[model samples]
Target: MSAPTYIYKLVSFSSPVPDPLPEKLPLSELDVASGFIHMSTPLQVPRTLKRFFAEDPRIYILRVKYSTVEKNIKWEDSKGEVPGEVGAEGMFAHIYNRGLGTTEIESVAIWERNRDWDEPLKKAESWLVY
Candidate 1:
């Protein structure tokens, strides 16, 4: 049987680079803007991502949100975790299992299946590209 597929949503913010800035400027000091929401599946997960979660032994449900400042991006999480701090770009909820190792994550639903949010996640890749 084929293994189940898993999908994750990632969001980021971006803005044009600004003019010269003072030394020791923090990210908060720059302009930021909402980028976009992207959907990713296990098949598409990068090697870096796999290495990052190698020892975690838990699957995750990630939700991401962002806003723009002058030209920098500010991130937040609906799950109460600090946004943009987890390395990857998004908010996440960890789903764990006691003895089954890790819970299998199937496909994720953002807009096509569910429309809970105003913005829906775009597919990781377009079929036309293939």
Candidate 2:
């Protein structure tokens, strides 16, 4: 099978950088506590946002392509560790870069309430593969 072209990371709208994301994304509190970078497939993003993101105003979705971090990324069982749908018993992508690790940024889009989550959601839905 061909390798996955992309994976997704959700960041707060108020990111560290003025841009949507920084050179290396800062891990969430949960990621820091668990010692892994939690990622989602297109299928997982919507539910992940609903379950964990709650009613936040500005959520940024990071589109990370495989070429960006091919060696560093691994698909492993989330093992019910993540808080949302990703926590279910299924393999999820974990970018194993500790602090400010290597991950190529393909593109970034915002997900705000009453705004443009639909197109991104549809795009993300296309990335689902087991």
Clashing pairs in 2: 42-124
The CA-based lDDT of model 1 is what?
Answer: 0.27
Model 2 Cα lDDT, one tens digit per residue, 1-130: 3456677777765553336345565678878876777787765677777777766676877677756666766667664244322224466778776433334766666666655456555654544432
TM-score of each: 0.20, 0.69
- List ranges where model 1 is wrong by over 4 Å: 1-6, 10-34, 46-49, 61-130
The superposed Cα distance between candidate 1 and the true structure at residue 46, in angstroms, equals 6.8
* Model 2 residue 45 lDDT score: 76
Please report, in order, the local distance difference test score of every candidate based on alpha carbons. Answer: 0.27, 0.63
Clash count (model 2, backbone only): 1
So what's the TM-score on candidate 2? 0.69
